[model samples]
Target: MQLFAIGINYRTAPVALRERVVFPLEQIKSALQALNATWGSNGLSNPHAGLPAETAILSTCHRTEIYGAALTGNASSMQASMDAGYAQCAARWLSACRQIPFSELTPHLYTLPHSSAVRHVFRVASGLDSMVLGETQILGQLKAAARAALDAGALGAYLNRLFQHSFSAAKAVRGQTQIGAHSVSIASAAVRLAQRIFERLSSQRVLLIGAGSMIEVCAAHFAAQRPHALVIANRTIERSLKLAERTNGRAIALASLPARLHEFDIVVSCTASVLPIIGLGAVERALRARKRRPVLMVDLAMPRDIEAEVAQLQDVFLYTLDDLGAVVQKAHTQRQTAAIQAEAIIETRVERFMRWLDARRGAPAICKLHEEAHRLRSAALARAQQRLACGEDPKAVLEAFSYRLTHTLLHAPTRALTQAQDEERARLVQLFGISA
Candidate 1:
């Protein structure tokens, strides 16, 4: 079996492309179901169908990736076919779902195989691959993705172990190094950007456009400055109210935004909406209402909640993910020493995982041994039953049954040793853990 990861990330693609491929949280389970139907899962499927037996997806603002394992025999042809199946399946599935042609998407795509894929995931889970250096949010995103895949019944032994190892490696990285110290989450980074545009958050009003975790984190950071007013707007007023209550902000319906938009000096949004919520015209009207007072707008959502054209309006500093990347890059230099230490720890953990995988190479032999032993057990049980039916001594029957079962189990190894050549005897002895 071969493990593989295929997708686009911040390093490989711009935000424009990344947004186009994002798998929304609500859609992840269904997507995994469809993927598993085409790509087999839990080693149950028609061999004729070409698909990975196990899979998981990690979709975030900065990336969208498919991690999969192809379950097939060790034959070279089978291995090659399994490899081709998943790599193409991932690319074609993503392209078809997003309505982007493969030619247009392939340039930004990256395919990592086997250990390379494992290491990539481990690094990502540890926040090493995040756009914002050492951010903790991506770790939560990773866990969410894993949970969704598990709920979808798409995660099997290979993927389950892979993610577990990645989580452990991440813990090791955090425990052994200061890579996370003073880490600037995208939310925190957004706050810093807003600070640059305005003199003080205490003097300004802030409007949060979503009640999601990212927006909540941003709300907490901005709330710390004790803004003149903090308001949360959501499709569901109750959800917004919950968020607003946490930050001591007021909750408003998303429908109220246009009429009340001009009241805020800063707007931050991160939502799962597929279309732009804040259109250019709405922002223009809000800008006019403010008499062109500058408003800092941060769009943290993948696929974006704010229209791109709004960034062109004078006195409106619109920041999307790309702009946030620039803001977070400054702190990347300070984490270099800690990052180096984290890499070393990850390398050691990865090597340990690889060694465990190597030990699993003996699994087929172990399976065969158990199968044969089971046959012996069934045969011995049948004989004991016949003796009981024949009215053999009840106590003596039990002793004979135990003796028969033990002898049957040991017979094959004993016979094989008796028939073995001198050179093969040592190997047989080691195989059975025999002292001689």
Candidate 2:
């Protein structure tokens, strides 16, 4: 079996495509089970019958990817199988759960296999591949995905080791480099942008959509502003209430969003919904109801919670995650020193990981060498036992056995070297570093 990772991220695909593939936290275990069942039945199971090939998925606002191990004839076949499986599974799941089409989605996908996948995952964990460079949130997301895979029994030695090593590499990078030291995350940047729009954030009423970490973070930032009122609306009422309680805010059911939309001056949404929750009509209605009061809406959702057309509305300021790029750019220079240090650390860790991979690749050869030696020793001991059983002297039997076993082991190498040509003999001697 070989290890592979295949999928696209913020750099390779746009938000439209990334959001279509993002899996909700609650659905991860089932999705991993489905993926394992799909691939295992297709001849991707482990050769040793120890465990099924490992599978884990990391799906966040910025990226959607699968990391797995599969048995295949070659690298190309492995890549093809992975791409096909991801496209097929993602389409089916999204269509059934989110009402998205498979055909409409497949074209936007990107697949990276084997070494490239490893490199990409490492880069992502190290914060080099994030939409907001040096942002540390991806590491936690990766860890969460790994835990989901583990819970679903889709993780084994190969993947467990790979992810652990990847995490260590990320830690080393953070420890050695300034990569994350001065980085301002998207949540913080959103707050910064909101400040530009309103004179006092404390006077603004804020509505946060979705109860996930990103939204929770934005809520915390907004709460510090002491907004006139803080509200959380989530598809799941329990989760929404939990977040609302934490922030000293009120909770509203997602279904009531239309009725509650016009009451807020600032809205920040990051949800797992595959479709737009805040459409042009909703925003238009909200604006009309508010008598054209300005509303700053930041959509952190992939695929986007707020429709693109909402940005065209006169009194609406709709900003997606992409729009906050410039606001966070100033910190890039501040983080350069950290980034350089982190890269060097990652480089060292990468070499160590590659060495470990190489050693694992040579394990069979090492095992075979020990097996051959044990066989030779067992055979020699068996012959000596037979001689002793035949009433031979123990010392003589032992001497003969030792002589025969020593000769047997050295005879082949001696004969091969004796028969070697001048150049071949010299090469062999040099290879073994023999003085004579």
Candidate 3:
């Protein structure tokens, strides 16, 4: 059986594409079972009847991926079957639940096979392949995906080993390297940049535009400064209330945002909405209401919660994720020392893992060697028993058995030495450090 990973992530696909393919957390197990059923069985035969291959699906805001090991099909055919199955399954699920077309979404898909897939998974778990480098959230996300796969009965030996290695590698990197040492998260960096505009975060009244994980992280960072007031606004009141309760802040419905916009010194927005949530007109009105008070705004959403034109407004400092790139870049040099240490650890682990893999690969040969040895031992014992049965002297029979066993053990090497060419014999003599 061969191991493979297939999927797309924030690096390879845009949000428009990602959202279309993203699987809800609730459906992941079923999705994995469906995929395994489709690929493991030949079409003419029972489509879902074969021993289902080991499979797992990992879907998050940043990426959606599948990892599996199967016995019958080659990589190409398996990948094609997976893609086709996913398209059909995704189409049905999306139409029934999300009202999206899977066909239109297929163009943006990416499929990684074999070692590339393995490398991609390791890099992802290690945070080398994230949209935000060294982001810790992806690690937890990966763990959750692995758990889901296990629950679906899709995790078999190969995938189980692969993921265990990946988890260990991620931990090693985080513990040994300074890659995640700096406060480079979009939220934290946004706050830092906002500090440049305003002298004190404590004096700033911050308005958070969403209640998602990113928004909560930003709110937590901002809360440490003891901001004057923090307000969370979300499309869902329950989500906003949950986030607001954590920080002793207040929650507002999304409908109330336009009216309440002008009361804040900073705005950090990240929403899952497909369209811009905070438009130029809203910011313009907010600016007017604040009597031209400078507002530092950060948009962390992929589809962009804030409007692009908002940047053009006077006395309004608008920053998108791209704007925070400079701050994130500044930490790269600072993290180099940590990265070097981490790479050394990764190298050692990689070598150990490769040795393990090589040992597994040699298992069949080792088994054959054991079987041959057992056969020779049994044959020698049977001959000794026959001599005893024939009333031969016990001492004679025992001596002959020992001699025969010694000859049997040494015969192959002796024959090879005798049959060797002159040059080969000379090399063998040299290898044994024997002077001719």
Specify the highest-TM-score model's number: 2
Q: Residue-wise lDDT of candidate 3 within 352-382, one digit each (tens)?
A: 6656755766777899988988899899999
lDDT of 1 by residue, 302-392 (tens): 9989999998998899999989998888889889999999888888888888777666756888999889889888888898899999999
Selected candidate, larger lDDT, 2 vs 3: 2
* Model 3 ranges with Cα > 4 A deviation: 41-53, 70-116, 193-205, 209-213, 233-246, 251-327, 386-392, 404-436
lDDT of 1: 0.85
Ranked by lDDT, the better of candidates 1 and 3 is 1
Runs off by more than 4 Å, candidate 1: 40-51, 75-79, 370-436
Best by lDDT: 1
- Model 1 clash pairs are none
Q: Which residue pairs come into collision in candidate 2? A: 177-342, 178-338, 179-338, 179-339
**How many residue pairs collide in each prediction?**
0, 4, 0
lDDT of each: 0.85, 0.79, 0.75
TM-score rank order? 2, 1, 3
Question: Model 1 residue 196 lDDT?
Answer: 88
The lDDT, on a scale of 0 to 1, for candidate 3 is 0.75
Which model is ahead, 1 or 2, in terms of TM-score? 2
